[model samples]
Target: MRPVFRLLSDELIERIISQARDILCDLGMEIHNDGVLSMLSDHGASVDSEKMHVYFTADIIDKALETAPDSVKLFDVMGRQTHDLTDHNVYFTPGSAAINILDPLSGEIRKPLTADYVEYAKLVSRLDNIASQSTAFIPSDVHEKISDSYRLFLSLLYCEKPVVTGAFTIDAFNVMKDLQLAVRGSADALKEKPLTIFSCCPTAPLKWSDVTSQNLVDCAKHFIPVEYISMPLSGFMAPVTLVGSLVQHTAETLSGVVLSQLTQPGTPIIYGGSPAAFDIRFETTPMGAVETQMMDCAYNEIGKYLNLPTQAYIALSDAKKLDAQAGLETSMGATLAALAGINNISGPGMLDFESCQSLEKLVVDNEICGMTLRLARGIEPKEDFPAIPIFEELLREKHLLIANHTRKHLRDEHYFPGRVIDRANSSRWEEEGSLTIGDRAKSEIARLQGEYEPSGLSGDILAEMTRLMRAEAARFGMARLPHEDL
Candidate 1:
């Protein structure tokens, strides 16, 4: 119900402001992108091209927060239900940008296909634990025709849940628009409530890319929520000190929020980051490393101080295989984020420094998400004391709480595990075929797939979507589209 950890107190927030001012004045972010620099100059923020630094003060950040909505309604594409981001419970979403899916049995990495992505999406949508879904897995290779927008399209087609997505290129915006049309069946549907788009802008200490900046502006105009993901690699792109990283992340995220607000006042935004560190010896960005977890915890504090909806990259690992280290890191990072009460936690099923995804892991992570959600609900105190006289009488004879009244309460209080999780003893498990967790998970996936009924799309609406997608493809000068079946 309440956040278990606070990263920034009143004194700490002031300290972050002081440090941000120092970074801008002394060591500034490198703005290699010219367009970003020009925008900064156009705004009141100071930009020195020579120094390649953009200095944004706390006042600018305040104005940005003021323009941002405290909460946003994330719409379900299937017109099922909307999730209120203002709720106290932390929501879990699937991972993002995974190029490979690690084979748990073989330990070999394989490129994921569109079918694989669709299956995964359906699986996630069916799970009660996942509050939202992301086109988390991208096909490693697709026909050139649909290569550009394949992931977004697949996500729109397969998922019925609220989607957490980002724009990879300028054209991706159009892809999103087409998908919106498909979901709503008409342009007027968008006017009521458009799909929430979370566009990531590079860190404050780093210039926003041209494509990313343009996408942010477009999303604001469409009234889509833009989630500014400030990924500052401390000890590499940023200072190694925690305070230093926090300051840089704050300034960068605030700047993004400001730009979105300036483009469209009252636009919703999430203060988010994927800040991590480069493993010096390994020469890699460790997604589930302890340092990454620490950064996530600290930055979450910073976001709370600003009083904005927060999103963080957690529930990932650096391990190439689903080994002990992978399990440990992913569990630790995910549990910490959940306990801290982050609004949105990403990076489930992610591995190999966030470059790979595993379907098996995704299912396993959903169980973790389910456990965390239960934990976040905290322990409920009994209102009526549960028939004190009867309970005391039962306790007097025996310590067993399995009496009729107690049994009823126990059933109500317990959180049941799904098919994949084994609570049975060895004897019972052996009788049931002695399946390992992975085997059981695969079976569960198959069962769900068999039972899943595709969301109803009228023939007319389907035709319209096909027409628009083809028209867009033609506009892009492509004769064929990738994943045409979608």
Candidate 2:
């Protein structure tokens, strides 16, 4: 773990604490749904439906935080890798829930398709820094051929990295099971180390959709780690005040933890959210705004106050095009999230309010993630700090001592540049056609794909996946598999 900067000053933290205490004591949260209202009422919270306020004592909030796990392990499908979540580093991914694909060549947004999903997965798999592969986007056209779960199936087959997935429907739950079976090779393997699956439940005063709630319960019953996503929009879904928003988020996430723990005690659950404010003038959720940044920072504080592992939404932008604004927003958001010690930071390759995905942006965001991780690690002191003697010896010695011990140490300490990021002069750049960042990123992606080899699955397992996929295709009444051979 690295030392994190306290985003909130001591006075600010105290103020937040005082505000939270006030909210719990006075203005309380609203619980519109009966189940949630009953749960709160059973606890120490006082529910007033007419006033739309639910008050809780400090003890209840403390209990919820105490219940959450400090760490979680996300398993790789091949059973080859498990990302230990205890390390407080920022992890990046391409994008999530992108309905449109930005054409790398033309820069035009188009409805996503199955081919796009496969290609996106392959692109994500080739990147070294992307720690986990997410179903990058929801293909708009796959609805007719296969259910929404087709993305999960494609991600499992095409992605070799650890996966982050969820079930959108009951059929999708079955698809998740089949996908898990395909990855683990048997039901017994699943029982041994079930793959990590994160499911989101909408925050109150709205009710959790039946489909998403059932999926979370099912994932818990199966012992899969579930990340309860609480996306509360301040001034809209939640109260306008910051502390009010935090309480609402905390309450909703605690509700999710309670359900998961009740279904199966000690099931791993993370306190996660993508909360932000609804811009009053535009009536749009601004992901890159300072308000969004503050919201994430404050929510993170609430998560930490509970002493649980935390996750936050950052590294995303609302920029309509990739330019300086995009760079600034993405860089700042990602930097803050990393410094805040968020376990898993999403929204790397995302843009245009997260409605579009871009390959170029993914590579850029990945480099930023690398830089953020390096920043978090800070600098370690060299065991022997006395380099003055070596410098003195070199200064006395005449010409440059290139092979000196000090020189050797200097070379060992530096991070070398790669093909994508250039450290060249203007003349050298002109000779190379003054390539744009996107052009360089495309070359890098091509280079990686050319050199990359898929992690081999057993021939028997491969054949089984193929057979199951074909059967699934047949059941869906599709004439052919999405890919002739996955």
Candidate 3:
């Protein structure tokens, strides 16, 4: 049997779920999408058009739960599967939508540019631990209307990993679909081998915006997976208590699933969240706080209880710099997310309360993810009565390092950190210039950026993707989209 890493009790799981049902059935939700309202009404929900209240009966939520798939398989740009949604695989993608890029050497936070997209995606592709890519930085240089689609375009261009990104509007989402088709060759092929998971966010306090709702429906209609990033801050946007906050999250997520399933049964929907607490002193939503971790673990437990594929917005930091504070907070949150068995963990490279992104931080977080993933791999004994083999080896006066058993099992039993992490003694460190992890990470980043090459997408496909991207930009009133390395 797998180890009991779950946080919520059997009874409490039922209670929280029950509270969510109450919230959905009694309180209903404020939905801003009329088409979604009509869809819900057609599926046995009561829709109040003027009040914008969409109520789900217990029966409807239960049916929607049944319609949601238990797992979602994500594929990379090359049509290779990248994640196992059923094995509790904790895949880390960089944090989504940071406006600024923190330069590792100069320590300057600069407005993101198109080149930042190329460099970031290439670095993430070369890193073994970064299993997927996200729209981590939106280039401030792009036209505002096509910014979201352009990020997806650049991510597809530079990264081979499966994309974890979103669209801001239905029109932008349509453009995103066209871009994927330009690469995949057809809509049917894109649906059958979805290389991206379209994320949609529901507003806090049980509200789903019109665009977010439409995005979910569009993803379902196209058979692409959808992830709901429910963000609720306690004592501000949500209730002060953890249970209260969880209840709101439950309702919000459940509401999304209901709409998605009504749009298309058997649609893949992920139970993902970034819920946190409101800090009074700073008046900020400190996503790396202890309470935020608790919220992450709690909602993850609820997701497990429902047996849905789970994700959480942890593996993050609130530190402005890549300092001790950043390491401490990011490590703790990553470990918690792994323990909770979150499948797709997003937040690497996040800093300054999710307002900034850094490439060095991405390398540092990779080591942390390796350690957390090692811990999540619960202990498995190799042999029965293994102490006898150990005793015999000791009796022979043979060092364990030279033993066959040691040679065979060391890789499984221990996690050897990457080159970025230092594990040597003081003397050895002095010989190696006493490089800090940051210094080593800088070296690694440079090596990756130098060695990286964009996968040679077919010339025909490349031209088509470019055409779709430029046409959308022109539609958005741009005479021309800014040219990059492409």
Query: Best-fitting candidate, measured by lDDT?
Result: 3
Which ranges of candidate 1 are over 4 A from the true structure? 1-3, 21-43, 47-59, 103-107, 143-148, 185-194, 384-387, 393-412, 474-486
* Model 3 C-alpha lDDT per residue in residues 1-486, reported as the tens digit of each score: 234366679798799889989989988999998999988888888989999998899888999999888888887877888887754667888888898889877989988888777889899988777799998988888788888999999888877888888997788989898888877778788877877888889999889899999999999998888888898899999999988899889889988889888899988788988898899899999888999989988898888788888888898899888889999999999988888788889899999877899999998898899888888887877763658978788679756777777888888789887788888899999999999888998998998889897776787877888788988988868766665544
Clashes of each: 0, 0, 0
Q: State the lDDT of candidate 2 residue by residue for 84-175, as single tens digits.
A: 66546456655577777777777888877777777777778777667887766777654444545677777776677766667666556765
Q: If scored against the real structure, what TM-score would every candidate get?
A: 0.89, 0.85, 0.96
Flag regions of model 2 displaced more than 4 Å: 9-67, 144-147, 186-188, 191-194, 204-206, 392-413, 466-476
Q: What is candidate 2's CA lDDT for residue 206?
A: 36
Better of 1 and 2 by TM-score: 1
lDDT of 3 at 476: 68
Q: Which stretches of candidate 3 lie over 4 Å from their true place?
A: 1-4, 383-385, 394-397, 479-486
Error of 2 at 50 (Å): 16
Alpha-carbon RMSD, candidate 2: 4.0
Ranking by lDDT: 3, 1, 2
Model 2, position 336, has a per-residue lDDT of 86
